[model samples]
Target: MPHPQAKIHRMFELVEPIATVTFSEVVNEAFLSLGMRNYWDGYFAGRAAPLGLAPAEVVHAVFYNFADGEVARHIPWVWGKVTPQEALAVRERASAVALRQQIGEVAESPGLVRVADLATRAAMSAPTEGRALYAGLKALDVPEDPVAKLWHAATLLREYRGDGHNAALVAHGIGGTEAHVLMALALGMQAETFGRIHHLPKAQLAAVVDGLRERGLVDAAGEFTDAGRETKQRIEALTDELAAPAYDVLIADELDELIAGLEPIAASISND
Candidate 1:
């Protein structure tokens, strides 16, 4: 049997959009309500607001995947546009609005309440050590609205896993750009797609690819070699292992129910 952590990790994959979807109309309008014009500004400020105006370099480290200058370009300046408390409130409201629209009346269903409870239990159970973003989010009170509560629960769990993933990457000696390259190659995404997202210049990107080649993680064809696949799998396994503690509060049946109950809800938003 797969490890229980692996099952929870797969469930996370299906439900992740609940926390990560940034392009929907409701989310956009909500960010605009904060008087934020640029998407990145809202993104950085809203996500990092939980850290209470952390320095740009600190945000860059905790975020752990953007290019060097990318995070620094936004951080403290974004705070000037919106206070951390205001940003946090807007984010919660925006998430609630979007979830309610997508989920409709089912947002308050008893079944959803139970799922939210299970997820919140797990989120609350997770330790704050080395999980800065998760720790920050957990410091706030959960929303009183059921739908917002669910969204908050999922967001907390997402950041919890994210912090663990970053730890695994750092432990493996992977730089942010290199990690992106490995993930793109492992998942069959275009390397340039990640390059554009991270603002990496072609020469720098080529150097990263070359370094991976030297390490036998990629071949001349730029596909994952056997070693590359194993390395990716190992990192993922470690991430799941680290994330497992959150779900430890759930019994086997409860874990199963959590995943099942979340499927339709996640499907609702994913198909929207």
Candidate 2:
């Protein structure tokens, strides 16, 4: 088998996107139920179950994901009607539809049968806090397809990790744009990706960059300053620490097996 660290990295490369993309269908459908077209409508509505929280409370649960100003701008609008329970129910129902569609689209291929067992194995080995957090989430009443079950579990665990990361960001005094800016500098990610992912106004994003620069976390060119780098590492470390609970279930071989199995499927998904 591959070395443990290599396996872990590959597992992330393979599993992360699947966890992210498949779940988008559920979140997307939930927003569509509200008859909205804007990205924010989908984003907010989908995550209104942020950590399985109510809409009034979800903002706090997802504090680090949206800037104080950005969240403030949109959350009040969202909370006027939707509750956390409502959003959660929407996500649960939408997820079953999404799973059937995705599975049917791929099941004809040989990869579907193979990937599901491996993916489920990986998810089963994730942190217990993350796994246990799933207790509160609405389950997708999927058909007797193992692949669908794995996909649903992986998606829920990803959401759990995200909620934990958001909590870390909040505790560290970082908010939406600032967290993105810091991550961009530390990870060498494009600043533009942040705007696209979060739907931040250009001016608002720039303003946050300016604020981070003032705090000595980033330089004039939007690179990490020495202090910024240190802070970034700490934040990342903390996030991993928070996320580690889920990964702790696996031994090295189990992780390697999961990664190796998923790599081909990840490739297949990417090609299509």
Candidate 3:
């Protein structure tokens, strides 16, 4: 049999994009209506909304991978213009609308209800200590509608896993810029692409890449060395292991049912 964490990881991967629906055009327009025309403004504000006017430093600390000033550029200021509660409302509503549009009839089917129940069980059972963002999201009320409930559950699970992943990176001694560079290499993208995503300057990005090469993590061409690949795998496996505890509430049959319900919906949304 696969490792015990394997199915839990599979379920998490399958439903991940349910939260990505928050980034769809529908959600963008909703943010526009609230005067958050910039995507980053919406992103930081919306995700951080459940935390209730958190400072930039707090967001930066919890988010753990943004370039130094990137979170500051959007937070505090975004809260000044739009309250966290308002942003939360817009995010939940727009995300539901976007997910509904993408997933169609499946959004209302009984199968989705089953997925929501099982996923919510896992989310609610997840550990809260040291997981700031997950704790914030967990504080919210579970939606009554099946589609919204599933989306909320998926988001909770995503943030839970994200919090664990951050801990894994920290434990592995990977800094934010270094982490982005490593992910860029792993994803087969230019290091600059990740730097751009995190808003790191070219010089800073180059420095990180050079440092990685010096550490024998990446070769001169900015690709992973054997040690780098093994390190990445170790970090990911640890992340998966940390995240697995949340799903412990589900019995074997329920896990099977949950995964079955999620797979088709996830496939539909992905292909859409």
Candidate 4:
């Protein structure tokens, strides 16, 4: 059976282009960091149906506010200072930059991959898979940032064995970081790459390793402990169970229709 959450996530994917484009607009206008925008956009978009915001409204808010001077100050130019034409031009340029950056970030961030994989698994699992994944996440006893909490859960579930390394590495590269850096060390990246990709120094990576070790999640050599391995497995299993239902619902016919509808915009964005 496909997991409820997995189905839900795939359903969400049907709307990802809309959400992602909205997010790009918001981040570019508000001057919010790429990380912060990704975190909020994912959380909000995922929960939008339950939370009562039209997905388009969420995107609108970011741009409107940025133009109105209501948020972050790092955007290239203040919204009010620019003419309407200039704003449009800037938004277009920024949108292009944001998409490429996001792809790169997704390629590099191990925590991101871990979360995505588990989410994929949870979606494949059962109706109860999302709840179970959330419960496991709660048990981690981490900080309150939802994004960070999600990352911790992903870290706990990641399959760090040698065979899994290549897929993990590819995900990191897409996000624009070294695979070993994010997965093994549980640290933010440091090296600066296209978009917002940053590469971490060796010492900083070691510090992350130490932090994971201190939490009993890993050993001195940065390998996951027995407890970590077990937890990760459980989460992955639950995600897998959640995804089953979604896989079935996402039948070939429906997917074909969705692709037909989405292809134009998706292709335009990619080409831009």
Candidate 5:
């Protein structure tokens, strides 16, 4: 059997888009599932003011902020005292701590030895994929304009699938939902795909597609227009530019060996 911690990591990886924004909620869910809710509540309460949040809002954000509205609803908790920027910073720091601790626990859990092993293998494989992606981007030609740069970066990031949300956030200044839309389109995914992969609803998916079209990022048939294609090419170029240095830093054989070691661990965790 996979360790419960492995299951927790899989859940975290799936919901990483919201991690910085909805840190408290993700941590609460993970800890609560492990029967550590009360312990966290007390710990957070003591750290709230220092973390720049009211205790209640911190707690609420951590567990209850599932969508946009939920986050908006809690705005009053720190209306005068905390700026939105500050709040995000607090959430990010707290979330990082929570995730690190969770991973540590998983690493220590005897039941998760197989899962941990798989995770090690996955990490090893990441470099090769990264290298291939970098090469693909370098092979593409994109203009040097700033607007073109933004578009290119967004498109290349979308190709990674794993990094698509980050690309979406950069391109649209909207988080998760918008990221999901861009990723889905880039991958030729449909409403059902979004539903299964990210648990998004049809209405939400429709809205995102519509928004992209309105912004001239995508077209009526959910295809990338000339502009969209240009944007994607630019993104790929940017990715290659950025990754080249890192690729040079690591030996290929080392990367492959690392991937071989980590693949099983990542697989075990996902399976769990």
Candidate 6:
């Protein structure tokens, strides 16, 4: 049996995107307090702030999979405006508002808290295993706001899974720009958001894209080639494979139902 935490991680994968997608409005609002004009700038800085009020380079190192050079341009500007704690507080406040919105819609939806309960069990059972990202997210003080508790559990699973995914990518000899390119292509990332969030220079991004093309992973138009598609799929499978063992605590049926139960919440928030 895989670790119970693995099942939790998989289940959370289904729930995590909704959290991020719905967070945009709340995130934009939170950045106002941090003096950031843009959401990406505020987001990266706010997120990495927990790692420390460190330099751009230092924060980049701690950030794991981001395209470093593109973001290196602005992190100093961001860190200069807010201390790590302040940045984190702003993030939590924004998350709290978003959480409230998400949960309230289901005020009458039966078993609203069920997903949170299941995720909490998985979080309680998962081990750290020297993953810094997981540890940092785990150390965050859980919000007592009833609605926020569900978001808190979902956040933990997302971070834990992300940290482990990076570890798996590294083990496969993927790193730096190539890793970012591979992920961006494999994950079906939106071109507009990718450019904005990664902030990679055109020349640098071009070079990586050119290299991926040379290796037959992408085509002239920058879409994934057949091989590229396969590579991306493999990476995701391996990521899930690496993350799977954590769910041994639940039976397959329970995991299935948990995913089913959360679909409506995701659907409800899909347009939000």
TM-score per candidate, chains pooled: 0.94, 0.70, 0.96, 0.30, 0.38, 0.81
Which is better, 3 or 5, measured by lDDT?
3
Q: Give per-residue CA lDDT, model 6, range 1-272, as digits (tens).
A: 55454455456556685447425777777786567867767877766766675667766665666675645766777877877778777777677677567656673444766766665666545677856666776777776654565666666667667777777767765666677777666568733347433666678678777887888888988888898788767766677766664455567776776677677766666555
Report the C-alpha lDDT of model 4 over 127-189, residue by residue, as the tens digit.
Answer: 322232223223333423323333232222221111123333233221112233233333322
Pairs that collide in candidate 3 are: none
Per-candidate clash tally: 0, 4, 0, 43, 23, 13
Best by TM-score: 3
Which 10-residue window of candidate 3 scores lowest in summed lDDT? 193-202
| Shift of residue 158 alpha carbon in model 2, Å | 1.5
Q: Which ten residues in a row have the lowest lDDT in candidate 4?
A: 154-163
Residue ranges of candidate 3 with Cα displaced over 4 Å = 1-3, 195-199
What lDDT is reached at residue 55 by model 5?
Answer: 42
Give the candidates in order of lDDT, highest first. Answer: 3, 1, 6, 2, 5, 4
Best by lDDT, which number?
3
Q: What TM-score would you give candidate 1 relative to the actual structure?
A: 0.94
Q: Arrange candidates by TM-score, descending.
A: 3, 1, 6, 2, 5, 4
lDDT (Cα atoms) of all candidates against the true structure? 0.84, 0.58, 0.86, 0.36, 0.40, 0.67
Clash pairs detected, candidate 2: 55-84, 126-246, 127-245, 127-246
Ranked by TM-score, the better of candidates 1 and 3 is 3
- For lDDT, candidate 2 versus 5, the one ahead is 2
The root-mean-square deviation over C-alpha atoms between each candidate and the true structure, in angstroms, is 2.0, 4.6, 1.7, 15.3, 14.6, 3.5
lDDT of 5 by residue, 157-179 (tens): 32333333234345534445554
